[model samples]
Target: MKFTGSIMITCVKATELIEKRQIQSLTLGERFKLRLHNSMCVACRAYQRQSKTIEKAISRWMHITNNTTHHLSQEKKDKIIEELKKL
Candidate 1:
């Protein structure tokens, strides 16, 4: 996890760490590397934001779908399926 001239982890590694962070807490080193990388990499910063947004949206969706008392109409379910498939 050396910053070197590139400032830190590669974009690929940054993306992986970003996703991994959603599943578990990152190590101190991992978080430091990710923060450094994001600070210098515009694309990676955007990716992090997008990844967080997607995770939050999915979490909300899961909560809604898992509520047995709040049933979705078949038509609404179908629409949801169609929209998800597009993604």
Candidate 2:
């Protein structure tokens, strides 16, 4: 679907909305913004798909970590924390 220029949502806003949906379900503005964006841009549609995949991977990783073990070597913890801080 083609959008009139007045209707196109910006990529940054679209990405924010997509991430919000991953964390929880979409808010009204997020839902509208994503729908508008996906309708207009193939790149945004691909971004939404990739975002969902990453969210799922994170959730699965967290679940596995919780089930397996909470303990880590101090060095491992420090390394992981450092990498996360970089992000």
Best by lDDT: 1
Regions of candidate 1 where Cα sits further than 4 Å from its true position = 1-7, 56-87
lDDT of candidate 2 over 1-87, digit per residue (tens): 333345557898788777777579965655766787789889888997888798789888877745656677999989999999999
lDDT of each: 0.86, 0.77
Model 2 stretches astray by more than 4 angstroms: 1-6, 23-30, 65-87
Model 1 agreement with the true structure over 23-80: per-residue lDDT tens digits: 9998878888888888899999899889989989998897774645767699999999
- How many clashes (backbone atoms < 3 Å, residues ≥3 apart in a chain or on different chains) does model 1 have? 0
Give TM-scores for every candidate, taking all chains together and pairing residue i with residue i.
0.55, 0.50
Worst lDDT 10-window in candidate 1: 1-10
> What is the Cα-based lDDT of residue 57 in candidate 1?
97
